[model samples]
Target: MIWSSSRPQLGFKRVAVVLLVAPIVALAPLDPVQAQQIPSSSVNAAELISSLKETTLQSGLTVAATTVRTVETTTNLNLRSSPSSSSKKLAVMPKGTELSVSATHAGWSQVRYGGKTGWASNDYLRTVAKAIRAGELGKTTAELKLRQNANTVSKVLTTVPKAGIFTVKRISGGFAQIIRRGKTGWVQSKYLSTVAQKPGREIYIDQKYTSNRAGLTDIYWTRVSGGDLRESVNGKILIGDIPRNSVVYRDLKLEKTAGSVSGWIFVHTQGMTGWMKTSQMSRKSTATTKPSKYTAKQVLAQTNGKVPEKMLAAIAWDPEKTLIASPALKDLNRLNAAFKKKFGKNIDIDLAYRTRATQDAYWIKLGPYVAARPGTSNHGWGTAIDMPETYDYSFRGKYFKWLKANSKNYNWVHRKILEEESPYAEAWHFDYVGR
Candidate 1:
């Protein structure tokens, strides 16, 4: 049964009345006169006026009908008459005490225990659904490293072989601290599983994009001129050419700059792990742009300098109007597709892929404060674009909201909003940050 408590009011009330009346008033049948007698104060006013804050038996307190176990196994939890620790102590509750929570306030929970109504700290409480305790057996799915601490960078004490079962001591930060062959240490949480449940799926280091379950759902079909499944990332050892419509896993980390196109993503189907060009991949690919090598000073001096032939050749122009880095073009195209689908039109782009001279000219006109100093501009990297004719944050239309929710999947981000105290706060400026 779902247990709900009346929204408590912040007003002066006796502590005894608050403890006894609140829970009963919540379940009591009410008539018009009773309903009128029940206090209903504005929540906004209570929150705004801190001094007026008070918890009453029949007001402001919420309770749950379900029983929960205490997580603290070694020590007793102090039960208080009121929510505050400074309040009078009612009893000392032993570890693993099952409590039926009637209401919760701040960090304290009001529970019914041994025919007594009192409050206990919420920190040591856990629901029955997740009641795993220390010394329980668990197994690691893959060859996992046991570390000194919960963090990934912690020193490795030893390695747990694939499917190695161990006794769990505790869990923190998604890592399980366990005892294996009398040795206690921490291992990556995703790899650990309960005894009955099998270990997590194996994930190779190079296959960084395949770890998250959310990413697995985003499967895209192949749309390549000629697609081949290779054994390695460079695709030097070609296994064989797969059919054009084969489903491939998009590894976000493997997407790198290759010639004019930046959409070379590491993909795998069955046992074939290989690199595939963005053009060869159908649907959306989570590819991002690599940072430009030219610094502000470099760009100023290299106005006449040529962009690398490999990079220059990869530049893809959409309908001959907008020029973007070949690697980022797919994302840009995807963004446009989404924008068109939602708003019945494409986003109007005013500029993309600026030359050093063009950037220097903008710097001269807008100055460093209003614009990025020459080479540092994202536009020069061919991974940024200016939407509409001008940048304006004040325009909060449906188009802007759509862009906010959808742009990141394509690696596009509004720099001004993401960065703090940003000198370049253009509302219309979006840069690819996937790299």
Candidate 2:
């Protein structure tokens, strides 16, 4: 049942006359439809809004209606006797309290509680939507880190891509513990938006790609013939292929959440975006000139310092286009691949194979101590490499140490005679021991 006082702005005389002549039916239970039909001028607009709630009277024989929409307090707010902030304070509404709103004027809402009606600022009130409770799936609103712990300084285990979805296992102070792809970690709770229900199917990103989801700005090129781009890594769907040495752009953020499988990087080439194996890409521009059609054996059979340029493989990762024996190029490429993975760049090369005339010129310019006697140097064989004389390639540098230890795995090794204390020592020299 619902009841309300006079809705009109009655003066003292009119209020007294209405009280004396009002009929008992004015206090009777109301039909919901009839209640709505009653004009706003006939009932107290400040006392009634909707008739959905049922409130039992103290005698327990009658009931009153309630509102259909509710507003919640977001912080402690002053309930004022009038809509103005300077109005007299009636009470203080605590955060999270739900209130039945009867009317709104200016920027304040008139709410009812405990037989009292007052106005509150709209700034501290919000519509009642279901809170994102536990056990729900949420999607990331930005690229975020999944750390081992809930703090920003904790070890970052992986990346949660923008729009990546995960199940919320629990939430801490400012972070949410989530599980994605069978791995569990914590991410900022504020960055996740809850979903109503689980998705019908999970997305197709490979977990390895998210371990380092940062955008890449470094340029690269295709190292294989007709480097192919597939719809997915290890996927049979072929998108297209680009010729060797074709420019590729890997620093991409397409679809906000695209990813790749292990050993594959998502890239854009020839106006298409797809996956290309990491093995088939390099920072070094491949030579357009093909390796001499002759076999490595036939080239080796020729006299030292007389090998033709056509018979040699142009080092694809070398910016200077240095030539090397075809047999050694593959292993060199492997070592460079690993180096780039560790250092985020290609190795700098100062020299590779030296022709007979070039070796003679070096001997006359640098003297016997610095240059190999014309034909006696290993540089004439197209198998020795000289790294640029940069601090990174020095005997005491990190690049040198890493190369000394790991290059052997790819059949490239630094000889002991090149140590700093040895005669004719050269710290920048490395040899292809495989051939």
Task: Give me the candidate number with maximum lDDT.
Answer: 2
Reference-based TM-score, model 2: 0.34
Q: Could you tell me how far off, in angstroms, the CA of residue 124 lies in candidate 2 after the best superposition?
A: 92
RMSD of 1: 23.5
What TM-score, computed on C-alpha atoms, does each candidate reach? 0.28, 0.34
lDDT of 1: 0.50
Q: List candidate 2 stretches off by more than 4 Å.
A: 1-298
lDDT value, candidate 2, whole model: 0.59
10 residues in a row with least lDDT, candidate 2: 1-10
Best by TM-score: 2
- What TM-score does model 1 achieve against the real structure? 0.28
Residues 1-435 of candidate 1: C-alpha lDDT, one tens digit per residue: 000111111222223323333343343221111224445442223222321333333254655535443232122455678665456766655545565567677656787655678876665565432323343445556999888898899888888787665556677767788755445788876675544311111123343322222234445655542365544545464434433344566655444423223556666542234566666776632222332443333333332312332232121222223445545656677788887787777677645555554445435433433345667766665667765422222134455556766798888987554321221223456877654
